[model samples]
Target chain A: MMTQFVIRRVLYMIPTLIAVSIVTFLVIQAPPGDYLTTVVARLEAEGQYVDRGQLDALRERYGLDESVWVQYWRWITGIVLHGDFGQSLVYSAPVSDVIQERLGLTILLSVTTLAFVWAVAIPIGMYSAVRRYSVGDYAATFVGFIGLAIPNFLIALILLYVSYRYLGQSVGGLFSPEFVDARWNLGKVLDLLAHLWIPVVIIGTAGTAGMIRVVRANLLDELNRPYVVTARAKGLPERRLLIKYPSRIAASPIVSTVGWLLPSLISAEIIVSVVLSLPTTGPVMLRALESQDMYLAGSFLLVLSVLTVVGTLISDILLARLDPRIRYGRR
Target chain B: MVESPPPLLDVRDLRTHFATDTGMVTAVDGASFSVPRGKTVCVVGESGCGKSVTGRSILRIVDAPGRVVGGSILWDRDGTGDPVDLATLDPGGPDIRKIRGDEIAMVFQEPMTSLSPVHTIGSQIAESVRLHTDLDDDAVRGRVIEVLGQVGMPRPESRYDAYTFQLSGGMRQRAMIAMALVCHPRLLIADEPTTALDVTTQAQILRLMVQLQAEMDMSVLFITHDMGVVAQIADEVVVMYLGTVVETGPTEQIFTDPRHPYTRALLQAIPRFGQRRAGRALSIIPGSVPDPYRRPGGCPFHPRCAQARPGTCDVVEPATVTVAERRDVRCVLAAEEVHS
Candidate 1:
């Protein structure tokens, strides 16, 4: 039964990705003119006489002269058949290469941030719920409210300044200048770890705070449930009773929302990444869109859409595993 | 008849209060009763009368903002050992933890919500067994299955892995009963265990509980508002009003010779079979249970009691007056009978 459900869900993602790709292609193309226009306009602004012949040649070279349907067809087929995302007009390189350069760091940052969020949120949420209205609960709530109210970029700026002023060290980017383009080594990895905290903390603050509230509210609801009382009556130690029952039940909502996290890996915290000077895909995607680098921008969005679909599938599977009610499709 | 065994659990002047935002609301106030060994005692009351809280106080399982403020839950585990005052033990301490499921276990009213939805029936039942016994995994599973079968769960072996939501209401209650009974507790406090089931299911569950009480030789403190259910399963009946036990006696005596005005009113309120006539409203107590925060100064039931005397019942609380063997009633009229 489980395998069948998973198989059906996987099959459904095909048409979903196709629909998402088409929408992505059209939206990227919907803006006025093409990447060539932006390039020509820039060259003209630089006071260079751009002849119409050179402009037409450049347009034809990049397949910009093709109809929208033909261009979309070519791009989609290339991605399907060759695992190619086409050449990025802005970088003068393949869109795949541009993304690949940052993909590892982006995934690392996102996974670490998610790990930090869950590790910090679940315990504090459980504490706040089990010891509800106590001193610690109040303090956690106050801090959580502040975290939720402040934007991530502002948090990034504050951390940067704090490190510079108090710690007497500049904490920005995923690596120090000495290791920015250094070859992979233990020293560079260590430096990466040292600088990783700032971005992870800033980006994770809002999510951790939000998740704490989610867990606290969900746990609080579950704690008051008769099952919890029943467990207590069974002489299960308080901590075990909490973790084994309400906490597990409370985690369902968190697992169900994990689908949103995948796309957020590349698109979320754009301003924070820019502020911290981190080498992540958010800034790259932003620049691609601004420069009307259609291939690069479209590829970024297509990957994000695909991640969203796959993320939803992953979350559904996880939820099914976590909750038998969902696994058996019973009410 | 065989002489009644010594009481398995004797509760004395139990006062459990909840510290709500407004003020301390005493849910169970100076209520007293006893559950004799191997018999069923039903605590009958309207909502907010603190029958459930009284049961929780005995088990020391009252939730946050609520606590057993003053009570002596004397648990005589084997009818030979000196009774231990459960109220004196720290609710979170190890001694109480050992006693909670090992010697005294409780089943809650909402079978739908009382069993963890994420856990399988066998695992939940096995939890208590594993906690109180040194049983291996296989033995624990064996004990759980045995209790599940005892509770009349259909095909206990196949149903072990079923989640609570997969079971019918009756089946879930049986699972709950199995969980409580897995430890072979001396006292089983069931707080309205069948109130949420359909009438047919309720009858089945009641019958099952009664049979289990006999087979396990365990005392049951059953809390419910259903007087009909009291008639069906109760050996002794304790009628409570606004956190106080107003009457206590054998079920037949409480039904036929109710002393307290509130108990009389409650018995009158029960709809008898073939007694309903078209166009006539079913019998009911005159007023709802009084708000706990704003309890009446004198007798809590004075505002609702049919025979309440303005000067006496409204000015002074009645004391428990023993008018017959092993029967007690708290009423000014009953007090007058004793004095006269």
Candidate 2:
């Protein structure tokens, strides 16, 4: 059943991704001028405008002089046929190559942050809910509210200051100066991990806090339900009763939110990455959008949209596996 | 001389109170009853008369702000020795916990919400079996299927893996009863187990419970507000009014010669088959149950009783009087031994 559901989801994503690509392409090209105008303006500013013929030749070579529809058609056909994402006008390289350089670092950071958030949020939320109004619950609730109130970037700035002042270390970027452009070796990976903690912790705070509130509320409601009472009356121990019954039910909504979290985390990373100067796709995507590099920005947005769709598909499959009501189409 | 064996459960003056924000509300005030082996004792009352609270108190499943304040719940496990006072034991202590689902299981009122929606019915019943007995996985599955079949669930093997929401209301309740009976508990506390189901389902469930009780030789403490249901299943009847037991007798006597005014009112309130009712409104006990915190000083039902004497009934609470062997009534008109 699950395999069939997953296969159907995969097939459905084909048309969805096509629609997403078209919308992304149109929105990128909807702006006033193409990347060629910006390139020509830079050349003219540097006193290097040779002739109008040369400019037209450059536009034709890049296929920018064609209609917006023709350019989208050519770009999509190239993508489908040869696994190409076209050229990045901003970086003067292929869009796939540019994305390849930064995608690994962004995925690492986001996944690490997500893991950190869930690891810390679920237990604390369970504790606060089960022992609600106790001293520990009140203290955890206070800290959670503070975590929610403080912005991620502001937390990043504070961590930076604390590290600089007390620890005497410059913690910007994903790697230290020595390993900045190093090859893929053990030392470089270790250094990357050492510097990875700050971004993960800073980016994870708001998400963890929000998740705590959601889990606590959901669990509190579930704990009062008749099923929970029945479990208790069954002579099941406290912890087992909690984890096996209400917690499993409460986790459905939390799992369903996974689809939205990926894109939102990437967007949040854009702002925080710019502040921390991390070598991730966040700042690169921002720069592409700012300079109107259509292929670069559109390719990044397309990947994000695909991730959103895939994330939702994964969450749905997981929810189906976890909840029999949804799995059997009873709900 | 031959003496009778002890009852399975003897609840004496069991008072369960809730400390609400407004004040302390006494839900079960001096509720005393006993369930003999292989017999069904039904506690009948209106919505707020504390029937369900009594059931929950027996199982020690009352939530926050509500507790069994004062009483002795003497549970005679095997009828061979002295009874253990359940009220004195900690609610979650190992002794009570072992006895809760193993020896005294409870089936809640709303089977729609009683079983967890995410878990399969087999696992739920298997949980109780595993908790009470040290059975292997195969043995537990065998017990679960056996109980399901006993409860008249169709296709027990296939239905074992069905979720609660997938089953109809009657099936869910059957699954609930199966879950309760998997351990072969000595006493089953069924709190309105069929109230939320349709008439046909209700009859089936009640009949199933009676059949199971006889087959297992397990006593039952049945709580319900429906007198018709009481007539169908109860061997003995205890009528409650405002947290107090107003009458206790055989089911036949309670139906025929009710001594307490409240019991009489409750029996009359049941719409009979051939009763002529051309233009009269339905017979009802006038005035709802009073605020638990501000209960009137005399008989709790005096305000609504047609035979109430103003000076005596309004001034003094009625004392329980023995009308006959194994029959009692709390009414001033029946007897005149006021101790308080």
Candidate 3:
């Protein structure tokens, strides 16, 4: 039964991705002018005006002269058949090659941030709910509200100034100056780790606060449930009873949030990335859209949408595993 | 009757209070009762009477903002060992935990919500067994299945892995009973276990509980508002009003010769077959249970009692008086017998 469900879910993703790709293609096309117009305008501004013939040649070479349908067809088929996401008009390189390093770094940062969020939020949320209205709970609630209220970029700017001023240390980006262009090595990896904390903290603060509230609210609802009392009456220790019953049930919403989290790996914290000067996908995608680099921007959105679809599938499977009612389709 | 064995659980002046935002609301106030060994005692009361809280207090499973404030739950486990005051034990300490499911287990009212939806019945039942016993996995499973079968769960083997939502209302209650009984506790506190079920299912569950009580030789403290259920399963009855036990005696005696005005009013409220006339309405106790925060000065039931004397019953609290063998009533009218 589980396998069948998974198979069906996987099959459903095909049409979903197709629809998402078409929408992404059209939205990217809807804006006036193409990448060539920006290039021509830039050349003109630089006092090196291009002739119409050269501009038309450049447009033809990049397949920008084609209709929207033909262009979308080429792009989609190239991605489906050859895994080619077209060429990045801004970088003058293949879209995949341009994004490969940034994509890896983004995923690494997102995964670490997610881990930090869960590791800190879950225990604190459970504690807050279990000992509600206590001193510790009040403190957590106060801090959580602050975290949720402040913008991530403002937090990023403040942390950067603090570390650079009082600590006399620069803490921005995912690497120090020495390892900025260095090859993959133990030293570079160690340096990356040393510089990773700031970005992780800034990106994770809001999520952790939101997650804590979710877990606390969900757990509070479950704590007073009769099942919890039954478990307590069964002599289960306070901690075990909490983790084994209410906490497990309370985690369902958190599990379902994975669908949103996966896409955030590619597009979250855009302004923060720009402020910190981190070589992550968020900033690159931002520049691509601003420059009307349709191929690069469209590819980025398509990948994000696909991740969303796949992430939803993963969360559904996990939810089924966690709740037997969902797995058995029983009320 | 051949001399009954000593009471398995003795509760004395149990006072459980909840520290709500409004104030400290005393849910169970100075209530006293005892459950005789190997017999069923039903605590009858309307809503807000604190019958459920009284049972929860005995098990020390009252939710947050509520706790047993003052009480001595003397649990005589084997009828030979010195009774232990359960109320004094730290609710979360090891001593009380050791006693919670090993010697005393509880089944709650909502069978649907009282069992965790995420866990299978066998696993939930096995959890208690594992906590209290040294049984191996197979033995724990064996014991769980045995109890499930004893509780009349259909096809216990196949039903073991079923979730509570998958089971019918009757089956869910059976699963709950199985969970409570898996450890072979000396006492079982069932707080309105059948109140959520249909009438047919209620009868089946009550019958199953009675059968298991006999087979396991365990005392049961059943809490309910249903007088018919009380008459059917109770060997002894303790009627409570506004967190206080107003009358208590053997079931037959309480039914035949109720001494307290509240008890008599409660009995009169039950709708009997063929007793309803064309226009005459069924009798109901006048007034509702008083708010916990503003309990009346003298008798809590004075405003609701039919025979209350304004000067006497409203000014002075009535003391419990023994009017007959093994029967007690707290009422100004019953106090006259002691004076005589």
Candidate 4:
């Protein structure tokens, strides 16, 4: 039954992704002119005569001279058959290669942030809910509120300044200047880990705070449920009782929020990466959109939309696994 | 010759209170009762009369803002070992923990919400069994299946993997009873276990419980507001009014020779076929239970008590009087009325 449901859902993703690609292409083309216009304007601003022949050849080479529908069809077909995402107007490389260069770092940052948020927030939230008005609970709530209120970019900026001022070391980028372009190695990995904390902390603060509130509120509601009382009456140990019933139910809502997490995290990363100077897709996508790098920008948007849909699907499956009411069918 | 064992549970001077933001609300005030081995004691009261609180005090599962302020719940383990005071045991201590589901289990009122929806029936039942015994997985599953079959559940083997949501209300209640009885607890505290079921299902559940009690020889603390249920199942009945046990006696005696005014009103309150006056409305107790925070100074029920006297009943709380062996009433006029 579960396998069939998964297959059905996976099949549904094809049309959803196709529709997303169409809408993304249209929206990316919605703004006036193409990448060549910006290049021509820059050259003209530099007092050079407009290179009409060069512009026409460049446009044809990049398929910018084709209609929007034709361009979309070519781009999508390339993605389907040849695993290409068209050419990047800005980077002069394939869009797929540009994204591939940074996808690893983006996933690493997101996964680490996810791990930090869940590890710290869930426990604190559970404690806050159980203890309620205790000093520890109050302190945690106070810290959570502060975390939620501060913007991620401001947080990134402050951390960068603090590290530079107090520690006398650069906190920018994912590696030191010496290893910035170096090949993969143990030292480079260690350096990457060392620099990963600042961005991770800044991006993770808001999520941790939000998740803490989610778990806290949901747990507090579940604690009063009759099943919890029943579990206690059965003399199940406190911790086991929590894990078996209330916490599991309370985690469902948090799991559903996973669909939105990646999108929000990516959006937040754009601003934070610009401020912190990390070489992730966030700043690249931001610059690509601003410069009308349609293929580059469109590919990034497609990746994001795919992540959103896949995240939602994953959350749905997890929720069904965690809660039988949603899994089997509505009673 | 062995002396007859003491009662299975001896609760004396029980007072459970909730320290609310407004004030301290005394829920169960000076409730004293005992549950004999192999018998059912039904605590009959309205919604706020604190019968449920009394049940929770026995298990030490009262949530925050509520506590057993004064009580001695002497649980006679095996009816031979020294009685352990449940109220005095630490709420989460191992001693009480062992006694809670091992010696005394509880089946709550709402079967729908009582068993967790996420867990399978076998797992939930096995939890109680596993906590009380050193049973391995196979042993626990076997015990769960046995108890499920004993509770008359259909297809016990297949039902083992079924979640609570899949079970109907009646089946869920049966599953709850099965979970409570998996360990063969010495005392089962069923707080209105059948109130949420249909009439026919309620009869079936009550019958199942009685059969299981006889087989296991365990005492039962049945809490309910329905006197009809009390009459059907209770070997002894404890009638509570405004958090106080106004009268307690054998089920027949409480029904036939109720002494306290509250008890009389409660018996009269039950609508009997062919007994009502044709033109008159059904009899209802004039007033509701008073707010717990602002309990009347004297007899808490005096404001609504028909037998209340002007200065005496309104100004002074009544003292409990022993009318006969194992029979008691909390009323100022009991002695005068009994003598007359």
Candidate 5:
């Protein structure tokens, strides 16, 4: 049954992704902005105002002289046939190659932030639930509410000051200068991770406060489930009842919410990453948008959309596997 | 268990309550009962009547907002001679942990939610055996197959590896029973375990419980609001009111000579074959359960009770008094003793 569900999910993804790609291509190409104007503006800003001669040469060189329809068709065909995502006007490199170079760092930050969020948030959530109505739970809950109230950028700035005030040097930055100078060996990796930890924690901490509340609500619901009472009545150890039985029962809610978490994290990361000047996807994507770099903005959006769909698909498959109630094609 | 397995389980004054925002809801208000070896003790009540709460409290499963404020849950254990108090013991405590599968187990309502969807039945059952016993793989597998067979599940071997989604409602209930009885727990706490099953499946599951109880010499705390099911399974009947035991007696007496008006009303409320109209269906208790937050000043049910003598019953709480050798009821109208 699990295998069949996984297969069904995989089958569902093909059409969904294809539709997403088509929508992305059409939306990106049809918008008023094009790659040529942004490139011309960047040059003009650098006091290299393009003459009419140069503008014509630039337009023809990059295939921007073509009509929007022709340009989109060419872009789509090139992507399908040669995996070409076109050249970035800003970076002046293949879009795929630029993404490849930066993808690892973005994933590292996202993965680290997520892991940290779960690690800290789950415990707080459980503690709040376990110590319901207590002073400590109230305090933790109050702090969590505060987290919701304060934007990540403001929190990021506060953390940056605290780090700078107590600890010497640029503790605010994502990577250490030493790590950048050192080769990408184990020592450098470890150093980079240590430096990266601060920003990850800042983003993670802010994000998890809300999730802590959500997890608590979900767990409370599960705790009230009839099976939970039965498990307890069986004299199953408290550990088993809470973590094994109720937690598993409550998992799908937490798991399903992860899809929403992915998008939220991108925006939250935008706040923290911009404040800290981290080399994370959020800042890059924001920069691309602000600069009106259409190819870069479109590619970033396309990648993020794909990630969102894939995340949701993963949640669906997990739900099918974990929940006996959901049978593919059965209901 | 030396004293002939000592009533399978014994419970005394199990007072469980919830400390809610509005007020304390006495869920299992001083409930006390026992199931003799191989006997089924059905706790019957309305939705808010604490039948399920009592079962959960006995299992030491009362959660936040609800707690076993006072109680003693003594259960027969295979490895120990003396019965242990499940109430004070942490559910994760070693003694209770060891007893979960090998000496005591539970089955839940809504098999869809009761069984973890992520795990295969085989593994879930296997986990029970693995956690609670020192049995080897072959022994565990053997026991799983045997219990699955005992529950009347078809294709035990194939079904073990199957997820719950693959099973029919009947099969799922059987699988749940298999998980519960994997180690032949001396006592089984079944909380409306068959309410979600179809009529045929419900009958089958009830039969399986009765048969298994006898085979294992187990006590059963069968929680339900269904009088028909209560009639089918209960050796002893405990009828609860808002959150207290309104009446309790032997199954035969409780059914044939019910003293409490609530019990009488509940039993009559069950629809009879020829007693129903087309639009108006089953008879209902006069009113809904009193909201716990703003319960009536005196007897919680005084507002709806037929036997309530306006002045006396609408003003004071009734006490549990002995009606006969094995019967007790909390009714103001019961025959009172006169002092010289």
Candidate 6:
């Protein structure tokens, strides 16, 4: 029954994605700038273009000389079947290759952040709400408020400074000094982690604070729910009440929102990745935009959207399985 | 009739209050009651009368900002008649949680919210069993099927694995009962257990509870606003008003020859079939429960008591004068009315 529903949903996503690709192609084309002209003109200035025949042949090959509708149709068809996102105007690489190379870095960072966020925030939030006005709860709330106030990039800069001055080491730039000499092994991994600690802590601190507040508020509300009180009356142990009831109900909404959590993750990474000069998607996207690297930039955007949609879809499926009320069509 | 033993739960002078930003609000103010083994005691009152708070206070599940300032919840572990004061025990203390499910289990209202929507009912019920026992998987599964059958759920073998949402309201209530009584707890605290069910389901659930109690010889502390339910199941009745136990006695005596005016007024409020308060609406108690923040210094129910003497009733909190064996009422007029 559940599998049928998921299969149906996956089938439905096909047309929606086709529509998204068409929209992506048109929007990029309709914007009054033609990036291909600049590349061609720059090459011409360097005495690369010989005559009208050569220029026209080059334009036809990339589909720039064709009608806008024809070019769009060709691109759409390529994406739908062959999964070809087209070649880059500036970087001159296939769009998928660009996405492939950068996606791992972004996922590595975000997933790590996700783990730290939940682990630290849940306890802080639970105890804070449970304690309500105790010194610890208030202190945690105050710290969370600091994360809300300070911009993440500014925090990143401060962490970098701390690593350089206090620790007398350059850490925020990814891999430590040893990895510069050594290769990818146990020692290199440990060295990278040590140096990455400052940025991870800074970025993670703010992320953790946000999650802590979210978990705290959600948990507090769930605790006051009549069901929670009922669980208490049943003479269930404190451990049972917390783990079984409040945790699940309180977490549902946040869990449902995970698919959409990427924008914040990407935006947060932009500054941190830039400041540290990490070869992540944020920096790649920025450089692609500056150089009018159309294929790379477009490919990055497509990958991001797919990741978000897929994430949300996964969350929905899991939620349906966890909850009987979700109606996964028990057939 | 086979007489039951002494009360399983003996609460005395239960004073609970919240030290909120707005000074102190008395929640379960100086209330007292007893629930004998193998029987039901229904605590009935309007909302804000501290009926629910009294039940939670016994379990020490009162969330922060609300504390059990002073009280005694003397609970008997078995037929030994030795009562343990639960009010003095720390909420996180080992002794309390250890006995919570094994000896005393609670069935919360609204099976939907009480049962985790994420898990199967069998898994949830198994939690109570696993917490205090060392049963293997097959043993736990066998026990789950047995309890489901005991609660009168149809095809218990198949339904134990279902989640709360898959079951009907009546079935959910039974599942909740199954969860609470699965361990065969000596005492069960049922707070508004049937309020969420339909009339037919309520009757069935109540009867099932009574049957289970007789079979297991367990004590039940049933809290509800429905006097009809109270009349049906309760062996003893406690009438609460403004955080105080206004009247408490055997159910038959309290219903038939209600001594306290509040009890009389409450019974009178219960709708009859026809021609009973002819062409008149239910006689409201004239006023709502007093605000705990601005409570009367004397008898808390004086403002709403129809027979209250203006000066005297409003000036002094009456002592719980004994009217019969195991029957006491915290009302000055009980004696006066009896003599009259």
Tens digits of per-residue lDDT, candidate 5, B1-340, equal 2444456577778888899877888877677777777678888998988887787676666667688888788775543558778888865567666766667777888887777666788877887777777899999888888878888988898888888888899899888888888877777888898889889888988888888888877788899989999988888998888877888889999988888888889988988876655565776788899877777867777899887888888888877788775578887777453111
Expressed as tens digits, the lDDT of each residue in A1-331 for candidate 3 is 6777678778888889889999998987788887677677777888985799977876675578888788788778878888888767689788999889998898888889988899999999999999999999999999999999998988998999999999987887888898899999999999999888999899999888988899899999889988888899999999999899999999899999989987764455678889998988889899998878878998888878877898899999999889887777832
* TM-score for each predicted model, relative to the true structure: 0.95, 0.95, 0.95, 0.96, 0.81, 0.90
lDDT of 2 at B188: 96
Q: What does candidate 6's lDDT look like per residue over A184-298, in tens digits?
A: 6988777766665555666677778888888888988888776676566555667767877888877777777678766567767877888887656888788877876766667
- Model 3 iRMS (Å) reads 0.7
How large is the interface RMSD of each prediction? 0.7, 0.9, 0.7, 0.9, 3.0, 2.6
Give the fraction of reference interface contacts each candidate recovers. 0.82, 0.75, 0.91, 0.77, 0.59, 0.59
Regions of candidate 4 where Cα sits further than 4 Å from its true position? A35-67, B1-4, B275-277, B337-340
Tens digit of lDDT per residue, candidate 5, span A24-88? 87766665756677677778889985788876875675478777566766776777788777767
Estimate, for each residue in B1-340, the C-alpha lDDT of model 2 and write its tens digit: 5676888899899999999889999999998878888899999998999998888998888987799999999999999759999998888778888988899999999987888888899999999988988889999999899999999999999998888888999999999999999888999999999999999999999999999999999999999999999999999998998888899999999999888888989988988655565655669888888877898878988988999999999899888888886688999978853333
User: Can you write out model 2's per-residue Cα lDDT over A1-331, one digit (the tens) per residue?
Assistant: 6677667768898898889989988888888888677777777888985588967876775578788778888778877787688767678888889888688899889888888989999999999999998998898898899999999999999999999999998889989999998898999999999999999998899999999999899999898899988988899888888889999999999999889988888888998899899999999999998888877898898889988998888889889888876766732
Give the range of the ten consecutive residues with the poorest summed lDDT in model 2 chain B: B272-281
The 10 consecutive residues of candidate 3 chain A with the worst lDDT sum are: A262-271
The reply for model 1, stretches above 4 Å from the true place, is: A35-66, B1-5, B274-281
The native-contact fraction of candidate 3 is: 0.91
Off by over 4 Å in 6: A33-35, A45-57, A76-87, A92-103, A175-191, A202-205, A233-236, A327-331, B1-5, B276-281, B336-340
lDDT of each: 0.86, 0.89, 0.88, 0.88, 0.77, 0.79
Q: How much does candidate 3 score in TM-score?
A: 0.95
Report the lDDT tens digits of candidate 1 across residue range A102-172: 87788788889888888999889989998999999999999999999998888888888889999988787
User: Per-residue lDDT of B1-340 in model 6, one digit per residue for the tens?
Assistant: 5766767888989998989888898988899888887778999888899887888888887866788999799988765778888999988777787777778888888888777776788887887777778999889989989999998989998897787778899999898899888888888889999998899989999899989999998889899998999999999999998899988989999999887788888888888776354777666678777777899877887888777898889898888877887788888887665456
lDDT of 5 at A169: 54
Q: How many clashing pairs in candidate 4?
A: 0
Query: Which pairs clash (backbone N, Cα, C closer than 3 Å) in model 1?
Result: none
What is the overall TM-score of model 6 with all chains considered together? 0.90
Please give the lDDT score at residue B318 for candidate 3: 91
For candidate 4, lDDT tens digit of each residue in B108-193? 99998888889898888888888888989998899899999999999999999999888899999999999888888999999999
TM-score of 2: 0.95
Under CAPRI classification, how is model 4 graded?
high
Per-residue error for B120 in candidate 5, Å, reads: 2.9
